[model samples]
Target: MTDFSGAAFYGLVARLDELIATRPGGADGFSPSARVRTHQNGGYRSAFRGRGMEFDEVRAYQPGDDIRTIDWRVTARTGRTHTKLFQEERERPVLILLDARTFMRFGTRDTFKSVLAAKAAAVLTWVSMEGGDRVGGAVVMPSGIVSHRPQRSRGRILGFVKAMAEATQNGFGAPPPRLEPTLAEAIGRLRQGSRPGTLVFLVSDFHDFDAAAARELNRLSLQCQVTNVFVFDALEAATPRGGHYPVSDGEAISSLNADSAAVRAAYAQRFAARRDAVEALSRQRGMAFIPLQTGDDPAILLHPERMQRTRSGVRGAA
Candidate 1:
């Protein structure tokens, strides 16, 4: 509530709202590529720009129909000419899927991973809004999910922010954690309901990511445009500076010794494998993979080109 960030490790409603002012002023401004992928043309090489046009259906060719749009195969099969008709994509909403598991609340630097994710999501929302797009999101938590349907209403936007703020701390104070639906199930729900042409930004540490989640993402990318934001704290990305550090998983307390080089190497390799899996998925889907650390500037989170100039590649991020 006081600054653009509330506390170093927590997020607040007012603080997240302040991120609207932090949107990048560059030409791109985090707007998704205007190209829309479709089954036609083998799902590649789009010609239209901005909102773009999508193939609607082939129909009986009329007298005034352009010969260029005629489907020759259909004409030969039915002995009647068919014409391809297209509809302009009118509304493509920006959807963000955020992970609010307990681990996201832990950080050793500028802000908590959860707070960083919230801020990044806020920036993305405003950026999309500036381009005249609808914005909405869902927060996946251990207790349950807090979801807001896509819309442009101010009230709905506020509700989305509220859900994320609560998510940073898991959920409302009273609910006990449950597995009614795990992260995989939550993603599956989104996969089933998300409309084609939706631009999805998934923000998560992805510590518990599994094959089921990957399957959902693979299917989801086939329809909607996806951008994966892999959020992490310094400690998670790298071994802490060769010292004894205390850590806990809510139920038990433990101390981590980073004095051994072998331990550090193993930790690095494990994080690297996790990070590579996410990055590979992004590459496979032809989408953006952004590795955001706790101390990185939230405004630059979406601009990988700019982020690259200033940030070095991390062997591990997550």
Candidate 2:
């Protein structure tokens, strides 16, 4: 099993700056630039920062009350003057729910869906962590179990990446306890651990899950900024024009001729319907859906066109 860790993983962080650069810029619209803001911790970096006010406390007004804080009403009642003050809200933690299910274990073009999902998670982690926002997430393993709580800190994010790599190698490569969680299960885990109003990235192939998951996601979105990263393999999506491929499961691999044009067309139609249904369900829930094709460049998936598509989908759904 290839260990996607150490320097190699750190190398991926470098790509984040480029990703941020490619993001649409502006104070409005779905452009990534529009999303840019100062780091909440008072840095000149990052594009998304906290905007809420932190309560400082009431203080007695001195000379320069500006009449706004004169507390005339209070003086009329209590014969004393007081004023309210508050601090700027700092950036909150960003939670990433990584669904490493059996269905995500398959991919045919670039890498396994799980791999791509993890990479995307890593990228987001770096962006958030370096942006001065805390980062943490829950890893949904098979049996619908959660591995950790929603955490904060760069160290915690790195530990998560390491753990995810290990799990992929152990469970997907050659195996011990081969198990995978369903999409609904993963969402449930996330809901349990996430704080309200947290920015969340739910990364998965979104396979073998019921529509109930979509409903739960909608509910979660009411509290958090939810983004869905839908991962898939090119081969699984578009069937190639080739001879029959053998299949086996505790059985011998037998060569069978490829299906006829009509059969292939039927299969393609079925797949198209399935994709449309999934996309539609997500859209109906007013979710930001990012469809990631393994064969395409990751940068392209994060491009303006795709990002705008997500924004429009969410708006239309709303």
Candidate 3:
């Protein structure tokens, strides 16, 4: 049995290994709709053009060859202009952007929002790897951003998991920078590291999401397949009835009087509004959205059958 007792609420050490071990079951269990389509060979094709090309060889310049691909060094050495030939790459890259900020550390359910985000990311990473895609990610922490360039190697994935563990253990010692700027920076890093056909996952509680973040997301979606994995605690949507609850953000503590009917109603309303706003933004941008609750089992939540059923039920309600 895995020893989960050593895990801090948001830490990744105890859980990551177990999550990786579960990869043998394969990621096919997740909804196929949630599986990202890349320009690469294996899966679905994207509507967008300009798939990444891998250099094949240098040959004598062909009349119809694009001049941009000319091998200047070869031309200079042999006094013959040569053009580079490239074929479409066989695999696409998957980038997971995780939020480990102060707000994500709080949870009243089975685990912290940060931990859930990590689990979700881990599962996604393993799935991507199973699909023969390169996997990489960035962990956005209050301390700083920890990122890994996408690669197919198992070592890279292990490194990414280690980085997430370190970031979570550091905790939120200082107030993080404003959400918009931090998101901008993270997006910039993604833009720098990823290619056009990359599948990007943005995992967070979205406490800091706003117009600026939305703009960044839109920009990213234009270049890549973007998915927003919104992780939240069950208590956020519905507080426990008739009890006073204490909450702390490391620096200070506050008590919530959930006994009052009016307060409970207002609290639930706030959470509902936030969820609606996120869903609206996802629809506007044509991005996929998956909501994961802290109390839920990650494996069950990600199960394809369960996801399809939940979505069907939601559509029927509407």
Candidate 4:
């Protein structure tokens, strides 16, 4: 077992630079395997379609030209049949809402959930910026929220990353706000800062996810493309081999008895139920759900092919 000492718990700050350096592969800087799904016509499609359209240029009319786009003025001036061409607009902004509550500062594997969330957000920021999209996000801490309006500047994206690192190091200071209220506040900020077509990523362990919180997220999803990146530890999905384990939350220490088969089964069932509820809520509200375990590399979420293969294996086994 790894030590959960002072330095280990809040060491995410030192890793911020490394996290920001992660670059997903592709000309668009998006992972080839990963695809964000968007809800359109009650069906799912690739989320990053570059859907927005912008007029590119006017050219001589072609056989299949839509009559509606026949630039009458240009045709008259040039004495030729001319058509207006539009290209896919790719300036969509990506807003990443990172949950940095105290609950997220734990991990039994590679690193704390907070660190993983920060790393994921950093990867997203880099990918979005490299893809020519505006990148910004809010870091939701227990004490308050640190938000950066979406912008196309590289400095802005790096600033957001720096803010996350600072928040991780300083801790929330005051008592943490209630989960639902915090989510609501974060969502409100997102609503104010983001446009309708923006992509929003909610990265967190979602420790106190509830009906009201889900409702808030649903409201956000109605306006923008939302993806829930749920960060959790492997221990959350399964209990360790029969043993008495001790846990601490800084202020309080408790022992968990995983010796009994029934206890372990019940623990696993509870976690599964919570996970199911989150997944169901995401599906109900047309949001994409990505689950990241603490032990796994955060980059895996960006890799679509790897995720597809994992899903295929799971379905085959079932």
Q: Pick the candidate with the highest TM-score.
A: 1
Question: For candidate 1, lDDT tens digit of each residue in 84-121?
Answer: 87655445667888877666776776677777887788
Model 4, position 42, has a per-residue lDDT of 12
Q: For candidate 3, lDDT tens digit of each residue in 1-318?
A: 333446453343325565565454744322234334443424544433222444556889879778988999999999999978655433457898978777787776677787777777777777777666778878888767877988778888787876765555454444655542276677667767877767788888888666777677778877777778778776787777778888775568999998998998888888777767777777887777777777666664355246543321122001
| Tens-digit per-residue lDDT, 235-296, candidate 4 | 77778887899877666789888898888888888877777777888888877788877766
Q: Provide backbone clash counts, one per model.
A: 0, 8, 0, 3
Superposed on all Cα atoms, the candidates' RMSDs to the truth, in angstroms, are: 7.5, 9.5, 10.2, 8.4
The C-alpha local distance difference test score for the whole of candidate 1 amounts to 0.69
lDDT by candidate, in order shown: 0.69, 0.56, 0.67, 0.69
In candidate 1, position 267 carries an lDDT of 78
- Least lDDT summed over 10 consecutive residues: which range in candidate 1? 41-50
The order by descending lDDT is 4, 1, 3, 2
lDDT of 4 at 115: 79
User: Which candidate do you rate higher for lDDT, 1 or 2?
Assistant: 1
Work out candidate 4's RMSD over C-alphas.
Answer: 8.4
Which has the better lDDT: candidate 3, or candidate 4?
Answer: 4
List candidate 3 segments past 4 Å from native. Answer: 1-16, 28-44, 49-90, 172-181, 301-305, 308-318
Tens digits of per-residue lDDT, candidate 2, 81-153, equal 8765544443445788876655666666656666666666666665665555666777765444455554555
Residues forming the 10-long window of minimal summed lDDT in candidate 2: 309-318
